[model samples]
Target: MKRAGTHRSDSERIDLTVRDYGLDGGIASAHTVRKRRIRRQTRFLAGLAILLVLTAGGIWLIKSLSGNTAPTTESSQPTTRPSATTAATVTPHPTSTPVPTPVPTTTKPQLSAEERQSLLQQAGDEVVHYLDQVTTGRIGIYFQNLVNGESWAHNDKMPFVAASSIKLGINTYLYSRVAAGEISLDEVLRYDNRAYPTGDYEAGTGTVQNLPNGTELSVRETSKLAITISDNCATNMIIRRLGGIDAINPWLNKISGIVDYRQKVSYTNYAGQSQNGRHRTCARDLGLQAVRLFSLWQENPQVYAPLIEDLSHTEFDFGIKQGLPEDLVVAHKIGTNGAYATENDLGIVFAEEPFVLCVLTEMASAERARKIQTDIAAIFYEKVASWPWP
Candidate 1:
């Protein structure tokens, strides 16, 4: 049995030991049984080791084929989303991000070119009808919508007596000077006989008017007086301050092509003699002045807005403001001469889209001129009121 155990085949030795060492064996048999028992234990242990090796290989092969090597342990659970990266221990993966839903919006109405033209033509027809009805004198009208820059005119290019309507030009130059820093609103001006002479600008007309003649007024105060009350003396002083009427014409020529009167023909320019045809303007010229003024203010509000603001509060609103709601802010200038029977109103009407309107009338009664202007303005305003235009 000893020779077969180690120096012989293991199966043969196990057989010999089991046969010789029966259940009732002697002391020698006991030793053989112990050896046999040890052999059985060794065989069982060997089988278990082989089975363990096979189980470990199977786990590795499954992990490789599935493209995952993370152990079934705490190391596999990540704290954050695993990135698409390979690591020495475990290869990681990326997860998808979700999308969100959107909301909607809105817009405004717009006018086509043909549609806008029709509206303008309708307004023009009404203007002509009203103008034809009144044959007492001549009437010229100008209108422009600031939004689309569309304009309509009737007898706009013909010359008309530029009554106080010329004041708009004079004051515009003053403001331009102020804008250039050549003049200041705060600077003091003399309303003396030199600028406002004895018969000039009605220095001799009223005691109240005469009182302020030799007195000093600020440039601001003078400008306000010129437009608000159509003060001739105040206008003369501004003309003087701006270095005479000749100095104002170059700027006027650029805007209107018509200049101020050369010789006085009426009481409006009581200070100077008026020239009728030689010093005349069309509705277009006056309308252009306000349009230019408005444009300049839009470009530089700090320097020129004061002119618009001052004109907005004029004391004389008879021609353009007649028959209109008091709430409509009309920044305008009016000139009327009973001798020439001329009534003129030129202004920037602050509508939803502010516009310029200049109406000049001659040889007509003041009452007639006023009615025509109001009616013409109403026609345009009616159309402008509904213009939430492009």
Candidate 2:
């Protein structure tokens, strides 16, 4: 008779199934079948071993009860000693085989590359539509996902009055040099005509002017005031320390990857030199500035985190910040020139999906600029926050 539960042609049937699956698939199926066969063989051998041990014990018990261990002989020989117990000796159980651990699978679902690109495209459309509906005059925007390399821009290369946004570059250059040990924070700089090479004196949006001419502040204090209060005097102090616009502009261009970052121009400093802020920057370049600073902070968080901290506490809150949630932390610098009708904000937003965003607008009044900036920020933040980021 054939086997009670298994057919004689089980392997043959499995072979037929593998052939039906085709050459490529047959290899995978065969691998699985071999593993199953090995496991079954291991179990069968263990059971066979237990059966033999039991059978031997049963025979020994019968001999011991019948008193028939040794065969009868004509001459008596020396008898072997008996084990002291009346019961038969039994075999111990074998240790079990360990099962291999399975690899863990990711719990969260992931988006395909095409899907991610499609969604980002949709976001860009929404942003452009919003701009068409509301904004007027020259406007430029740059946004980049820090998590992924995907980016979006609208007129990002267009030049705009840098206004106070240059503070981002000035302070970043200062912090980077300080980290590299090229400059020290304790070094004292004076607020005088030296900071204003074009006979400029602090007059725009800071408190350093209130301290009077020739007021000496440490590089640390000046850096703090320049960012937090948008202090023009403090900014000039930093600019002078970095060797002024001629010295600072090249470094800014090289690191920011922009041709025109902060070109030198005549503007009023303290004591009524002139009444215009002439520094120039654009949206994309400003975004690069923030991105580079983010890299520095990543390299040595302790050394660069203070700059982020200072950016978080800046005085102006009407531009990009006006759109974000109040609870989240946003480190940014604001630049404005009511005279030139230029307003801008540069920032690193720490969102569910963090990003660098820079928005620059010239010829738009302060009120209109605020609305345009905050609204665009809201739209982008929604898009980034909704992504199923890997």
Candidate 3:
């Protein structure tokens, strides 16, 4: 019985062993199939990755060549505006060019000669009425409209003491020489007491006399002093340099009919004539001088620039300027000889309608003369302001 049992166990063991071996072989075959399937999947994934890389590279190269990396907004389908209702529609408006508006121009009023003469006569009568109130002294007035050339004169031919107004002739002659290039404005001049002796130094408007002897000044500087400050010493020096009244008279007469009946240098030995006769100028003549000077300045500004500039700096402003608006400019010169009781102002008024005025008074108080001047200026200003055009 023991031998038979042992034999049975050995058979059972052999059968179990064969079954185990079969199971192991089946597992090995299944593992080999799974490895093959994995390899095939890996190869397919790699090929797909390569295809994607090549497609991306081609797209990048095309964008680089075209220089257009910005995203495009192009659509394959046509777009339509949003509508509240499906049946709603839109219509485009017609386009057209616009026309500009035209601008209008201003025109000036023209007056007849007879009308102008009548107006001038009316102005003269008004001025005469104003002068009638002054019972004490002789007054002369000359006025002319620079634009229309209409003029009026009241005792304008009567001569008065020129006083510092003679400086205007001196200045005109000096500039005339400059215009002719006979003398240079840059020439240096010595102001010695001997040249304009201390005895000849008049005690009036000036600074050149107060300056030390042997002081040097250019012709231009001396002229400026003569005109702007009515520097007596400076005037004498210029007159001496020009060779006295004889040298200046011919030039004055030759140009602009400006007649100075007795032209004399200021603060000189020969300047002490009678008050009636010392350096006399008529209102008409002085007015003409101012007109000529303005014309000269307009014609040759380079030569007359200094004279115009000097006149613009007139230190005395109690005459025509007092009556004028501050905005207006008056290029003027005032002459007052208290010894002779003469007061005169000649100037070009740069009003809307410019004019020349010369007011000469004798035997009147300074205040009265200034009042007459201011009134005369106001009359002209009113006339100009009321004029129809600029």
Candidate 4:
């Protein structure tokens, strides 16, 4: 029985050993399967890492290439306007251009003789028409061609009071006296108290100054005063000094280019009378006086040069000067009275071709007459100066 028992133990031991071995085999197989799976998984992870590296490298290369091709894309994209400017360098753009301005010219057409004459006649008729509107009495007007030595007068036959414009006639006579050496221009004379019977202190009447009862002035100065200011006292003095009334007759008759004469009244008798406003001449005669003065100024610029120069410095602009351009220099005489019927202006306008014009009017108001004369003179200036008259 012991032997049998021992053998059984050995068998049992053998079985146990087999069982242990089987268990070991089983654990070993599991370890082998697990190691194989781990190795496969490690291999797969390595391959995936390589693929990912390759993909990242490719993306970086592509970006670098794109950045090189388009310079602004790597940084921020450039603005649209800047992009347009850059594109313009590669491709030309269509653009609008600017235009320039034009200049002015000065050439004008020349007028013909018939055209000028017709213009003058039309201008004269217009002047006459204008004058008729301002005067109820008579509107006497005259014009002279100083260049051609011709004259025209409407109502030339009638005589109006010289008023103050006779100063021009007095000026001519005074100049004649000076030219003849009858009275020296530099000769001084005492003021006679009887000369200024109409009160000596009238404004714009020149230097007819009563001389404080004993003041003295030169004949030239007196003549200047007579003309420039129309001083009645100075005029009286000059008339007395000029060989009186009959003396001026020959001088008046001697006016050859145009002649309109009325009987000469002596200065002494004329002034002495209570009914005397008698110093008289018409528009034609006054225009003649202007022509004569202009001719005198032209012929012998030295003879009456100072007087003409002085006359050009007219301060009384109410009559003819009112209508003329301020730039024009006019040598003129004006006449006015308290009575409205006689207001006149006679003047030589020194313009393109110097002209002689006379505007005489008889109306109810002296102011109205002066305005009429001014309007007429303006018309003459407008016509003669190559300006439109109407």
Candidate 5:
């Protein structure tokens, strides 16, 4: 008998379904055939029932599990979501890339050769304005700073009949001689009446005759009086002691860098001299002289310190020193014979930014000249206050 619940080939099944014949063909063994067919049918029905039960159990399990799970939403695509803590721990790209920027090269602007000349020409415009104001009488003026560089009015080339201001040259020369050991500052210098010379009344009657009877004074005292008070007698005495105007020439040449710095003794004394102040000076050169004096203070501190310190001792405040702040020092020398005719002040005006002024004015009246001096000084200080130095 064929085994029940076993797979049978199609040919075998068909063969089993047909009645098989024994060698003797009687009825094909009726009882044997019936029993074999019944067993095969029972095995097939049991397999079908077991297969249906298994299918139904599998569907039930799937549906029951799906009911307890999260519902599917439009936004819930099948993707792996990272934990919030894990996302927070991750580093992110910077909003902007850290690109290396090329450093900017800074180059100072260079002025063309012509541009330098033009700058000076522009400064000249202001000079011309003042020059126009003093057209009535000869006008001279200049300005500069060793720190500030050079600017001019009738510079060294344009000579003015330097009046008492010439004492500046004399004093500077004498100071140099003393520095060189040619003269002793303590050496007593005598004043012979002949050493004093007389000039126009604008130069004045002088004060030499007023010196104490046959009294001798040291070179130091006389220089002080000559420079600080502009005593004409004292100046003449020093000039003679320094070996006359000729002795001052070599130094003057070196300083002025020109041959025109001539000194002709024009007075016996400067004290009480009418101050004809008519002594002429280019506006610019006088200013430069003042600057040079200040520079000397800087260059030879030991030698010039006292002199510069003593500049505050200047007695005349009517010129450039007028109207300036009281605290600021003005080391200046002023000259004017009468009113607006000729007025000049050469010296350094110290403020935050110090500068030298050499202004010469020959105005319509001495009063006008004085007024111009005051006005110009005020204007200059105002302008300098705005300068870049401070």
Candidate 6:
């Protein structure tokens, strides 16, 4: 009999007659064929199971390499399965990249030399035209635009009586001494009969003269009186303290554009005259002095602030200060000599665009000179108000 659960080829079936002859004419059984077909089916099912296992392993390897997790299925379980609760609660994160912030930029406009000169000339002509119509005095004016550094002048070389304006130079000398540590503001000086003689007592602009003869005032207080009130007695006291005109003139000469600065004022007179001669200054020099003082105010406010403060409180403002808006600040000095028929004002206008302006007049009455000064100042203010300030 043929073996059970065994398969045979077609050739073998064809040769079954020979085999049957050898087997003494035996025939194959149906039970043996059925058993052989069942065995083949079992082998095929095992091969399909192995193929599914290999495919699953390959998918898991690909997911791990790509930094991802393979999905779990209900029908198949991996070596380790995430808890159903953990997998269900997972939330996806956004992958958007961060952006950078932007920076701000600024733009500044520049002026040309030609344009600056043109503006300066136009302003100069306007000032000259207005001043010519107002007074018959010999006027000297110097103007400087603090912003653009443009300058204009009329009769700048001419010299006129310094009058009380010499107090500016006096105040500057005192401050210079203080800055050099040669003197102290707190140091006191006596207002005695020797310094202010009762016989030669000047009745001009200060209260210090009326005080008791031996009353003591600090260098600080004396300087304030000289500038704020245009006090002749206080000025003479400070001049005497500084060793008279000989000592102060050299300091004034060091300033640029200053041609003539001489004479010490007598207590009996507001005019800056002595045995030496009358003190003289020009518009150009006064304007430059104002510029220097402004620079000092900017560079060393603690040391120079009091001088500017006293100037701001100047009680005589019938000139430049009269023309400006009441809200504006002007650090200036005014000089008037009724005997000489001279009136002048020199100062820095602290406006939207700050500037230095000096107006000096000679051979004119006080009333006419002041009117001319006011008109000239008003014209400058108008021009500056129109300019585009930075």
Report the alpha-carbon TM-score of model 1 versus the true structure.
Answer: 0.65
Is candidate 1 or 3 superior in lDDT?
Answer: 3
| Alpha-carbon runs more than 4 Å astray in model 6 | 1-110, 195-203, 263-277
Q: lDDT for each of the candidates? A: 0.74, 0.75, 0.75, 0.66, 0.60, 0.74
Q: Can you rank all candidates by lDDT, best first? A: 2, 3, 6, 1, 4, 5
Candidate 3, residues 55-158, lDDT tens digits: the string is 99999999897877666786677568554553365544422211111111233536676776677787777888888876367788889877677888888877
Model 2: how far is 32 from its true place, Å? 99
283-312: candidate 2 lDDT, tens digit per residue: 888998898888778777767777888887
Ordered by TM-score, highest first, the candidates read 3, 2, 6, 1, 4, 5
Work out how many backbone clashes candidate 2 has.
Answer: 9
lDDT of 6 by residue, 118-149 (tens): 76788789887877676565789998877666
Instruction: List pairs with backbone clashes in candidate 1.
Output: 164-335, 200-271, 201-271, 263-273, 263-274, 263-275, 264-273, 264-274, 265-274
Each prediction's TM-score versus the true structure: 0.65, 0.66, 0.66, 0.62, 0.58, 0.66
Residue-pair clashes per candidate = 9, 9, 0, 0, 20, 0
Better of 3 and 6 by TM-score: 3
Between candidates 1 and 3, the one scoring higher on TM-score is 3
Where does the lowest 10-residue lDDT sum fall in candidate 6?
A: 96-105
Give lDDT: candidate 4, residue 226. 77
When 2 and 6 are scored with lDDT, the better candidate is 2
| Residue-by-residue lDDT tens digits, candidate 5, 1-390 | 868989889887556656374333346566666777899998899999999999999999999898869586655553477678868997876321122112221332245435533554555565567656654555556766333354544433444456676677677777767777888878986665543453111124345546654568898887887777777878878877777766765665565533244533232121223322323345555565666666666656565544554455766677666656655677677765553245667777765556677766554566666665666667666655544321
**lDDT tens readout by residue for model 4, 1-390:** 356444557778767655555444555755666787899999999999999999999999999999889855345755656666577777443221111111111223255556667767877788777755655555678877554433556776455666888778767877766777777888876666653333234343556654565468788887777777677777766766666655665677566313323454332111233232345667877777777777665656666776776566655677777777766667888887654356778887765556787877665677876787788777767776773223
